[model samples]
Target: MTKLNCPFCYNTIRRRSELHFMCRGRPTGARPACQPELDQVRSNLTGFKEATLPTFEAVSENLMLPFTKAHCPKCGGETTTRACSHCHTRLPMEFGLDASPMVAMVGARGTGKTVYLTVLSNELQKPKIRSEFAATVRPIGEGQDGFGAQDQWVRESIHQVYEDRKLFSTTAQAVDGRKAPIVLEWRGRHNRRFVLRKFRTNYLSFYDTAGEDLTADDVTFKLHYLRAADYLILLLDPFQLPEVQRLLRLPPAALLHVREGKPPIDVLARVTEALKQGDHWNGRHITVPVAVAFAKMDAFNQHLPETHPLRARRRTLGGYDEKTGRIIHEEMKSLLHEWGGDEIDAHLSGHYRSYQYFAVSALGAEPDYENYLVNPRGVRPDRVEEPLLWLMHKGGLVPRAAS
Candidate 1:
């Protein structure tokens, strides 16, 4: 029997060892005998060499196990892996049939990330994007998907503060027990049909992170997940534009910590450093097609027409139009043109890589917790789906059939 390590508590024990297996902390009596179905998994991989390992598709088709040797440092339980080597938490290799393209959400504090994620969950359920993507939004991890465990603080933070109409902050008491990370999956158009007209690319896994985490000094563990990420959606709050403008006007005034501000500059600076670090670590230009998303455009919509003198320039800036459905204010385009230049193109000539400018509003109408995000005139999104679509296209998750 091969010795294995517990993935949960990082405990290591051998199959022949006389230790009861406990996962993550839960003690399983006698390492519950492997079911007949799972026993076959062990049999198949018995003599298999690591070099000729079966593909994810093969395991999914055969209903084989998705387990690997890992050490469980806590319980001395060997054979512990992402799937339990012992006990009933065996892998459902079936779920492994499709390997999802991974995407991570990272941004600064108070960027309305939670609200944006909450709304993205609801948006993905819509017909057009849902059909095109063949995926659904869901909560995964720990109590949900039995994965690497979800962060409870993030889950409750959104629910209590935004969903439950309760105030939330680094100081405020949580109203909704604990927050869970929202994990959504969906199938993209087959690439063979679009590319070589042979096979579908891969499934997509969208993971949302809390703003607080992105700003932390040490993102060692968090940075790991982002290494192989296909795309990164960075939320940039328009509220920060004012602060940046204010500072630019008074270069010597010192950067003041604005109250209830969205996307603190200090946090943004740290996030930037982390991204650079990730690029260094991965040895790949962490240029994972970023969407410097201007979230909650409704607040900035009123200032659109009057934002800048040039009307066409304002449209290029980006905005949402109630009449035309999705509108890009010229001012936003101007800003992006100023930052990255060239009408917010995919990439600039020399500096920067894949990037785009977008304006989006999560709730359309401001989420008046006191008023339940009331839109008496009926709900209308101001270019809410552009950023996601842009990302999907860049990720090859959605095919440009015409191409």
Candidate 2:
């Protein structure tokens, strides 16, 4: 049996042994273990009180037993759904039975993670792209038939970016205890030996938190989700790099908007430390594939020559091209050195067993700021889907061509 990670709380559930049940009545008004501390933090960050959260009780049951149902101990109501043994969040129907890839997005504040996620979801759901991979992207559980609150947020974020051509507001730093993860189910045919034979379904869980929450040194408990990720996407904002900011020669007004938090290297260090505290390697390098991407590539194009590898575009709907990806990786490495990010490069190399450099531009052009909205020319994403496709290829979800 596979040990599944909870998409909501980032808890690992050992399917064979531990099974947790939640009240079907959806009991409310009870507080979680860390509610008081979390509430204080949320209030300080967003200046608002979090709503009361539901309480979930753990149920110990033997799967080998013949019991067909469970009942909540407190409310005595019939419990029909399973939850994460650790966080008590509801689990999807196929949570333990199928392969689920937990992809975590990490970066300093103002790194465009929200935009990347919005575009990545849009690209994955495109019919042509889905046809190329023989995959269909759908919501799971509460989001299966209709949009849950989190699903609605994702849909609205995507619509605002793609249809309305407006930039999403920076994700708030406060943590909402009631927030559920946006879980997507990917069903596709696995092509093997030039034939589509096995049908595979994977649950893709995305956790998008405010960048400040990730870099908070005083609060590490809330960021435990980083350790449970199967893959990590470290988005390095070019604009955040001090050297790049100087080189870009932006106007003073643009510089004023740039809020520099912890450096990318520092953020990566904290993530690696979190992994060490968990079951992730002890005194060993992390084996999970880490895709360190340079986001907002369009802003840096002026510095690169016309023949730069980053300027080369590939078909977004086709299978991943390792040759092209490698070229971009090398080019990005060189650019990182030029941008005085050698420490970031060195830290990744020393801590991760498998790492790749990528450059992606979610918006093809810079946005025109109008009040709180940023209107771009059009949604012409450059290589926004490559990092995800690369992760899928590395995980063996898609067949890799012979080297």
Candidate 3:
């Protein structure tokens, strides 16, 4: 009886005894769109005209009865798929029956969020990792004829980072020009039980926007999808830490060259304001788990002691080590304080009731720029999946154990 959230519109669908259906094909005539909200979503994803939108009609007349399929009332054509009752968008095969976790990745510019996402996707698709987790992750709406803009962007991004070993360009800053959010479907069974009960599917949607868009004053209205996220991963760039920049002798030119957008504190404040507006935190701590991770840790790995928890690499994947996660969390918090990021630490602690810290390096080593291309030594990610694994464990989707 779990509640399902529409990946496109972020509308919550309550559990019901009977199933509902919506037409999959576009309306033949000018019957008028039944769901204007869904039409807006379609228009945002694709440049389709609202007047030529598909219409939805409920197939079942009784709430306690089951309907295998239905016909579009407008065209009299049969439909074999199901859709969200609130929004007419087609639902995944068994969407309403399983759990779907919406994850949002947010950070200031040059925080390595895009690189982290690219590497994380590659890591999740690895044979050994998928075998250990007993899951298969793939992008949604990829094969569909109508919706392909967002899917194409994801494919290009992954190919660039994993195949070509090159970095992606800066995210588009204009709200209207930005691509749609990347949505993925993770289908697998639980690792705890041996006997087969029923296979479960979880939909994971990611929203990656330009760092400038997040810092804008009108972000609350622009990025309304943040309100529907089940988990938040806030990436903090090591180069932005004033103490780290000074200790490493990183020149002003280097900082300016990388387009260091805004301080992490300011970006986080803007995110907090948006969350408050959504009633996520009403003068109280928010329930959504936040992972405050230090991206580009490879650049600063030399500064840490040999015995530092972050220096160790994770080997197994069936379950997370709670004790080890806590150790790293505390170590990262201490490092932030020493790096003159105590204000950022304080802000997170005050607003989020449940939060943890992590350190990750997407490239495993700093890339050398030559002839306008980077990563001459090739790319090897180090512990890039740790944050995702931690979130899965916290949500009880994966097991947790002490090291």
Q: Look at candidate 2 and tell me the lDDT of residue 160.
A: 90
By lDDT, the candidates rank as 3, 2, 1
- All-Cα superposition RMSD per candidate: 11.5, 6.0, 4.1
Tens digit of per-residue lDDT, candidate 1, span 313-344:
22121222222212343445666445333422
What is each predicted model's overall lDDT from 0 to 1?
Answer: 0.44, 0.69, 0.71
Worst 10 residues of 2 by lDDT: 31-40
lDDT of 2 at 347: 90
- The pairs that clash in candidate 2 are none
**Over 4 Å off, model 2:** 16-82, 86-88, 142-147, 174-179, 190-198, 252-260, 313-318, 369-376, 401-403
Off by over 4 Å in 3: 15-41, 44-55, 61-65, 85-87, 174-179, 191-197, 251-254, 257-260, 305-307, 313-316, 369-372
TM-score of 3: 0.86
Point to the candidate with the largest TM-score.
3
My TM-score estimates for the predictions, one after another, are 0.55, 0.79, 0.86
